[model samples]
Target: MINGSTNEFIDRISTCQDTVFIYKGKKYWFQGYMPNENTVHMEIFQIDPAKEGYVWEYNGSSITEGQEEFQIAPIFDGKTFWEVEQEMEWVDC
Candidate 1:
């Protein structure tokens, strides 16, 4: 889990800027994160504007329903999406 607030997570990942990652020939992009209640809202683009994967509001404990849908989101382990992005090569958008 992230060791700090959601904003902190966002700041930490900002160094990556906007980026895309290819996993198993699949493309994923980083959108943004928002902190709500005791959870963090994470959003990522799966297929441009129509498709978004794994858009969720997650607290340190669990994931609850998000405001958006079409979450084909990758498996999130409580870390920021950028943390996951660091593990993959960048793909040009």
Candidate 2:
């Protein structure tokens, strides 16, 4: 919790994965962490728009990597997806 508001790290959903967004044809993997004070349950994978691998995590757990659907929301970051999905009916990316 950066500011206790949770919104502090909200928009980082897209860049929060081991993905390859090309420009000079070089891919970079950014790291994101969502600590729940104790344990961390997350899965990093790729969905769409990004042929590379993206990560989606939460304070809990998911069924599998291939089961994470719903893009406009999940943000595919990890903790943010978990937090937003259950609260706002957002989709998992």
Candidate 3:
């Protein structure tokens, strides 16, 4: 249910698969997804600030720190996010 702004996010979700996202130069790893009205809440893997990117699912977004509580969070993890999107029938091939 993501809009155009999320297309690149979606694309990487399919193609890259393993590329991590770095937000505020921090890691926002792959945690899970949630139910949003139009866009499903992309739950980023919570970062511990004490760990690095390769350890957990922690791929952060260039997205700002406070952005997490904003109106939108990107499809955080590419691979699984796309899988969930496909399962939810949000995007078409």
Candidate 4:
């Protein structure tokens, strides 16, 4: 788990250009935070056979060079960063 306050996690995510995390065996790319709603917007990733790498899709639009369909898991669990930190593992990609 992250050993700091939620602010720390917010700071980390805010500064990092590309933040990817693994939660419950799935890869999630951190999009941004919704402070007022207390939710995090994350894009779900899947392996793209054509690109030979991972890719994320938004609203049926591909962000990478692949045609795979993926979903955006906007974390609406109403959990704080500190609570979420316990379940997420940061990926160094």
Candidate 3: C-alpha lDDT:
0.36
lDDT of 3 by residue, 1-93 (tens): 332234655554433233334443444444322233333322334353645333322233322322332223334343333344333322222
Give each model a TM-score: 0.36, 0.21, 0.27, 0.39
- Flag regions of model 1 displaced more than 4 Å: 1-16, 33-40, 48-87
> Which candidate model has the greater lDDT, 1 or 2?
1
Query: For residues 1-93, what per-residue lDDT tens digits would candidate 2 score against the true structure?
Result: 321232422444323443222122222233344454444334444433355554443443332222233233345344334454334321222
Question: Candidate 3, which segments miss by more than 4 Å at Cα?
Answer: 1-6, 11-19, 33-42, 48-93
lDDT of each: 0.42, 0.35, 0.36, 0.42
Worst 10 residues of 3 by lDDT: 62-71
> What stretches of model 2 exceed 4 Å from their correct place?
1-17, 35-93
Q: After superposition, how far is residue 76 of candidate 1 from its true place, in Å?
A: 7.5
Tens digit per residue, CA lDDT, model 1, 1-93: 222343433443343244455543455565444455555444455543445445332223223333222133345445434446445445543
User: So what's the TM-score on candidate 3?
Assistant: 0.27
Off by over 4 Å in 4: 2-8, 31-80
